[model samples]
Every structure is written in structure tokens, then in C-alpha cells.
Target: GERAASAAARAEAAAATADARARGDAEVLARLKVSEAEAELRGARERLAELAGVEMQRQALATELSGLKAGQEERDRAHAAELARLGETFSGLAGKALEAAQAKLAENAEAVLARHREAAGQNLEANRNSLAELIAPMRETLVKYETRLGEVEQARSEAYGGLKEQLAAVASGQRLVSEEAAKLVSALRSSGKTSGSWGEQQLRNTLEMAGLREGMDFTLQAHQAGEAGGRRPDAIINLPGGRQLIVDSKCSLNDYLAAVEAPGEAERLAALKRHAAAVRGHARGLAEKAYWNEFGAAADFVVMFIPGENFLSAAMEHDLALLAWAFDQRILLAGPINLLALAKTVALVWRQEKLADEAREIGKLGADLHAAIATMADHLGGVGRNLGQAVGSYNEFVGSLERNVLPKARRFTEMGVERGKKAVAALPAVDAAVRPVAARELLAPPADDAAA
Candidate 1:
């Protein structure tokens, strides 16, 4: 029993010790797990801090993107406003130009037309005065002839009759010429085709008067192909340096003729207004053709030829802006007088060009002639030097003969080697020298002094 109690006590002690060791091991493991949890919490806090920094960066990027988008929108608005302002400014300028042109035309129309009419009246008066002067001389001559015929009536009766017939025929011819002119004026007012032909004929006459040839200086009814179809200009005048000037003679005269024939003043005024409108219409049509674009070197403006000055004057009287409008359209409204002046100017330009060509040719010939003269002078100088050398040689030969040969011959004569009555003839030395060349070109210093 005692042994049993002792073993039991020992076993109890062992159990208690084992239990304490297990408790210590469990505390150590709990401490280790607590350390691990604390480290995990620290890691979680660091990850949260990183996420906050990313959120801040994302917000900054969004703010920057929004600012860029707003700036872009502002710039687009400014660009659009600028474009609108420029368009408005352009429109205003165009309107102002047109208004100014119209105003200027209105102010000048009446004064210009009045001046033209007054000039026409003066020209008519001058022509009449000239005609009267011519007729007065003819009248005096006829009177003298009449007196002479009466004095020798029987002998010169047939001659007097012939003279009378000749005078009558001349008067008849003058009347015929006047009638033909009237007929031509009437025909011009008859139809469009006739009127166009008349205008072209007048243009031809004006060109001839200006001394422009048909084929050489100008062409009639020239046909040019175009994208639309083809264009036929009435006349294409050749300018200097291969430039061209187009002239159209298709201006209508029907409205102007109607105005002239109108019975009442109101009707005449209405017809004149219509005439002006027709002219404007024609100018617009010509502008659309863009003849300058078709020709490589054509004048910017096309000439619109009106056969009659009256027609143009009447149109301008109603519509003061007719000329200004035509100018805007790049169409020049030229009456007979205006066209003649233009033609004359062109002819003068051609003459000036011809004179320039002739001057160039003359200058070239002068240069060539100068070179030839220089060559001749050089040759003449050479000939002079040769002549001088020959003269010097002749003098030396004469001296040698007098000193050596003549003295020996005279000594032989003195010795009486042979008795001869004929004396030895003395030869004369040449004293003349060749004349030097006097030309300045030959005597001048060499082009390169070192070479000389």
C-alpha cells in the first residue's frame, strides 16, 4: 500500500508538469498569431494609402482633361466668330463699292451728255461753213466759164454744152451720194441682222481709217472653240507683242429706233429706258462669255461697238449708270468716235514698235561698220610701215654706190684705162618717205598695255 501511494503521488506530479508545459506552448503560439495579425493590419493600411494616391492621380487627370476640352471649345467659338466677321466685312465692302459707282455715274451723266451734244453742234456748223466756202469757189468758176462762152458763142458752142453737162452730172452724183447715206441709215433701223451688219461694216471702216489691215492687223468673225460650244467675236484686233483685243458689234438698235419714232414725249422716254435696259442686258451677256479667259493674251475688257453715237447717247440719257455698269462687267461701250480713237492709238503703238525694230537693226549695222573700219585702218598702218622700210633701204643703197662704186669708176677714168667720151651717169637717192596712217584707232594704245 505504501509503495502504491508513492507511485501515485509521483504520477500526479508528472501529470501537473505536463499540463503546465502544454499551457506555456499554447501562450507562445497565441503570441505568434497576434504578431501575424498586427503585420496583416499594417499591410492593409499601406494598401489603402496607395489606393488613395491612385484616386488623387485619377482626379487630377480628369481635371486636366476637362480643362483641355473647355479650351478647345473656346478656340472653336473664336474661330467661327472670326470667320463670320470676315464674311460680313467682305459683303459690306462690295456693297459700298457698288453704291459709290452708281452715285458717280448719276452725277456725271447729264453734264457729259450735254457737252457731247454741244460738240456735235459745233462740228455740224463747221462742216456747213466749209461746204459754203467750197461752193463759193465753184460758183465763181462757173460764172467765168459762162462769160467766156458768151464771148465766143458760135465757135465754142459744143464745148460749152459739154461743160454744162459735166456740171449737171456732178450735181446729180452729189445728190445720189446723199440719198444713199439716208438709205443706209434707214436700213440700220430695219432689222437686227441688218443692224448688226451695219455695225460691223462701220467697225471695218473705222479700222481702215486707222490704217489697220484686215488679215494682218485684225480678223473679222473669228471663231473660237470653248467648253460650252464656240464663240464668234465680230473682230479680233492684233496688238503688238502677239496680244489680242476682241470687239463685238451685236448691240441691238431696235429700242433706240422705236424711241426716235415714238409720237409722244412719254412714249419716247419709256422707249429710251427700255433701250438702256437692253444695253445693260447685252453687257451682262458679254461678261458671262469671259472672252479674256478663253484667249491666252487678250485684253481684260471686250469692246461693245455701237454703230451710232445717237444710240449710245440716248441710252445714257435714260440710264446714267450705263457706262459704269458696262465697265463693271468688263465690257467697254464704244461708239463710232470712241472706237476710232482706240484704233488710232493701237496703230500708233504698232508704228512705235516698228520704229524700235528699225533702231535695233541700225545699231547692229553701226557696230559691224565700226569693226570693218578698224580692220582697214590696221591694214593701212602695216602698208605704211613697209613703205618706210623700203625708203630707208633705198637711201642705204644710194650711199653705198656713191662711196664704194662711183669713186673707183672715177679713178679708172682719171687713169685713162680706156678712152671713152660718154660720162658715168650718177644715180639719185630717194628722199621721199611713206605717209603715216593718221587714224586714231591705229595709233591708240593696245587693249592690254603689258601685251604691247
Candidate 2:
């Protein structure tokens, strides 16, 4: 029975072990199923949560879109109103800009018209002046001729049978004719309508107005010298102090007028060159003349005096080469200012000459003074010697009186009136001899007196 019990126990233990093994396998399978169910549940929950989150996001986006649409509508309305206002403002600004532009254009147009009118008026005035200047000479010449003709007609009509009256009328006509001819010659030489050539007239007028008289102190003339060899200067002015100056009026009115009237560049240039050449030729002629030699040849050089400043300026402007040429030949050119300066220089020279004369007189006076001083010195030496001799004779006379007469006079006085009378009676002989000696001493020279 115990053996049977052991077998049973062993079987029971084996079955229990197999049952435990089956229970373990079933537990593992159950745990695996639970884990798989837990996994599926967690996945389903996660899907459900994802759906909820997606629905929430969609709703939030719809809310945001609704807000954005409302804001966009408001912005559209504000932008439309602002755009309308901006259009109106821009239209007003454009209108103002157009008005301002039109006003400025009108103002500029008026200014341009005014400038054009002013320029035209100035041009017209210039043309008129030029024309008048051209016509003036002809008009003057015509008037002069008419006057002369009228005077001649009058003389012929008024002539009488008397010889004196007829001769007088003839002389008058001749004088008129000569005067007119001289005027014509002047006009021709100057190529202008001036009474005298401008320079000559100005010089004459200035001198006259300054109280200068010709022939009393000086002589002025326009003369041509040199038979056929030397040059003839324009004017020879002789001064009071035996001084002479040559003033050559070098002005080419023809060339200057031609240049002024030339309408084209080529003509103007040619005229200018001609003027320069004429001026240079005149300058050379003046240099050759050495006209300064007229007054003892005292002056240094010839003065090339231009009548008009314009002529000198134009010549210099056109060609400075002529200036160099003039200088090379010892020709001195002078314009109006230079002419005035020269006159003043001449005045100063006159004053200087006077001063020189005074200086010479002073020199003579100094020599005379020196001679007088020498003579006075000789006279003073003689006087001093005489004075010394006089002083010596006076002292000697006092000594002689004291020594020869005092003791006798004293003895006579001591003897009383009778003896004194007797002494006085004896004094006549002594007085006679001493008076003669004193007279002889007075008749001699001081030098003789000193010797005695």
C-alpha cells in the first residue's frame, strides 16, 4: 500500500506540475491579450482626441476669417472715401498749377515784348543820330554857300557910281570870298565840318580863353615848309621866350569815317589797316622833319598830336604794331589828355625859365655883395689905424701940457697976482710955438702922426 501511495504521489506531483505549466501559459496568453486590448483602446482614444482637435481648429479658423472679412470691408469703405477726397484735392492743385503757369507765361511774354520794344527804340535812335551826323556837314556847307552868294548879290545890287563905294563893295566881296575859301580849305583838310581842324581850333580857343595873345608874346601858324626836301609839320608855335614847338596834327578823318561806315567785316578791316598806315606814315614824316628844331632846335622831339581821342584809341586798338613803329622813330603821340598835359608842361617850363633868370640875377647880386664886403674890409682897416693914432696923440698932448706948463702955472699962482700977470705975459711965445706945432701935427696923415 505504501508503494501504491508513492506512485500516486509522483503522478499527482507530475500532473500538478503540468497543470502549473498550463496555468503559466494561459496567464501569459491572457497578459498578451490584455496588452493588445490596452494598445487598441489607446489608439482609438488617440484617434478620437485627434478628431476633436481638428474640429476645434476648423472652428477657430472660421472665426478668424469672419473677423478678417469685417475688417477688410471697413478698410475698403475708408479707402474709397480717401481716394475720392484725394482726387478732388489733386484736381484743385492741378488747376492752381495751370493758372500759375499761365500767369508766369503771360508775364514773361510781356517782359520779352518790352525788351524788344526798348531794343528797337535804341536801334532807331542810333540810326537817326548816325544819319543826322552824316547830313550835318552838307547842310552847313549849303548854308555857308548860300550866305556867301546872298552877300555877293547884295554887294552887286548896292554898288554906287562913286569910286570909293564901288571899291569898298569890291573889297568886301573879295574879303567874303577869301574867308569862305579859307573855310572850305579847312573843311577839306579836316575832312569834317568843324570851323577849323579840331586840333587847331581847340588849341586856339584854349589859348585865347586863357588870355593868351599872339604876336605880343608868341605866333601860331599852320604852314608847310621845305621846298621839296624836308617834311612840313602841321603847326609852328613860337613862344615869347624865343622858344618854338612843332605840333603836327595827325588825324585821318577819311580812314576813320570809312571804317565807321563800312558795312562788312572785310571792308572795315581794310579801312582800319588804311587808317593805321596813314597814321604811321604821318608819324614817320613828323620824325623826319624833326620839327622840334624850329626854335633853335631846343626841344627834344616832334609831338604827334592827335585831334581826337577816338582816333588815337581806334588806331591803337586796331594795330599796336603802329605804336611800336611810332616809338622807334622818336615820334611822340598825344591824345586830348596828353595835349592838356603838354600845355601844362609848357606853362611849368615857362615858370622854370623865370626861376632860372632869377637865379642868374641872384648870382650877380652875390658877386656884387662880395666886392662890397672886400672894399668895406679895406676901409675898416684904415679907420682902425687912424683911431689908434688919434688915441696916442691925445695922450701925448696931455703929457706935454702937464710937464711943460703946470710947474710954471703953479709958481705964478704962489707969487700972487703980480707974478701971475708976469708969467701970463711970458706965455705968448710958448703959445705961438706950441700952436704952430699942433697945427702941423693935425695936417699930417695918421701914419705920419704915429711916426712923429
The best candidate in terms of TM-score: 1
Which candidate gets the maximum lDDT versus the true structure?
Answer: 1
lDDT of 1 by residue, 324-353 (tens): 989988999999899999999999999999
Q: Point out the worst 10-residue segment of candidate 2 by lDDT.
A: 428-437
Q: What TM-score do all the candidates reach, one by one? A: 0.54, 0.42
For model 1, name the residue pairs that clash. Answer: none
Per-candidate clashes come to 0, 0
Cα lDDT, model 1, residue 179: 100
What digit string (tens of lDDT, one per residue) describes model 2 on residues 1-452? 54355445545544554564477654343333333334333433444554456556556655665565566557556755665565577767786775565567557755765665576566556655655654565456455545644644544344333667778999999999999877755575565446236666765554444444555423456444454545445455554367666666655667777887899989988998888777888888778766555435435666687777888888888878877778778777877677667666666666677799999999999999979976876676677677667766777776777789887877766878354233343322222112222433224368966698
Q: Give residue 41's error in model 2 in angstroms.
A: 99
Q: What's model 2's lDDT at 352?
A: 79
